[model samples]
Target: MTQRFEYDVVVVGGGPAGSSAAYEAAKNGVKVALLEKEETIAETVRTSGVTWIQNIKEFGIPDDCFNPIRNFSFCSPNNEVTISDTVPRAAVLDVRKTYRWLAEQAKNQGADIFT
Candidate 1:
């Protein structure tokens, strides 16, 4: 037997964009189903993992989750420069935890998540 689902929106992928879409739609009382291809939502992270301090504050994400690097060093073929006092900023993240958390949040908001 083939199971067919009827939803207001069928969202593919469980990344940041997909999570946000599902969240917003579900929050509006729309039927949403989120699909993720990977078994583990947050497995691979290829990012340098650097984001601005203001973004973290705006997003309301806690500092404890990130590894704060106060200084940034840039190395180019021509030159290298290091800046100090990049306060309250972070560069490293546990991608696995973050992705899992996002998936959880979407689920909690009544969005059916499938992997």
Candidate 2:
């Protein structure tokens, strides 16, 4: 038997977008329900791992989540340096941990997170 309940807002994913939305909405005293199809929230990294890092700071994300890699090299198909930049940045994220943290934030805001 399946039981269904109504909510003011139902978020269909546990990814960044859906999780953020659910967190914000619930934080503002809205009834929210977050649904995730996968057993683990983070599936894979579809985009490049590089990011300005400032973006995450702006969103109040913790710096400990990233690995500070000061040096990185780039090589093309022909072994040409198409692009290279010496910037203090970080990579290597525990995707599962990130998702779990985000989901926890949403849950803390009174959202009902379910798989």
Candidate 3:
């Protein structure tokens, strides 16, 4: 027999946006399912970068998934830019691991995840 599944909301992609949607929906008592085209979440890091510290906390991303950054520097042929803070307000995420973490968060929130 073929198994059939249904959900109130279906989200495609296991990336941040899709995962977030599914997570929020699940948190609000909605039956949601998250689907990823890749065999695994974050199977490849296409676009990844730095983000604010508050986002990390809001997303409940673990410390192990990011490296806190307190400084930034940029250089060009005619100019150089430097910025620093004693307290870290931003972080560089480990893309692959962080993506997996996001999926896990959605799962924990009661959303079904299908890779």
The C-alpha stretches of model 3 lying farther than 4 A from their native spots are none
- Candidate 2 lDDT tens digits, 1-115: 9998889999999987888999999999999999998876676545444555666666566666666556666777777443334775555555556666788899999999888
**Winning candidate number (TM-score):** 3
Which regions of candidate 1 deviate over 4 angstroms?
Answer: 76-80
lDDT: which is higher, 1 or 2? Answer: 2
TM-scores for the candidates: 0.80, 0.78, 0.89
Report the backbone clash tally of model 3: 0
Candidate 3, residues 1-115, lDDT tens digits: the string is 9999989999999999998899899999999999998889988678866889899998888999999998899999999999999999999999888888888888999999998
- Give candidate 2's error at residue 52 in angstroms: 1.9
TM-score of 3: 0.89
**In model 2, what lDDT does residue 103 have?**
81
Return whichever of 2 and 3 wins on lDDT: 3
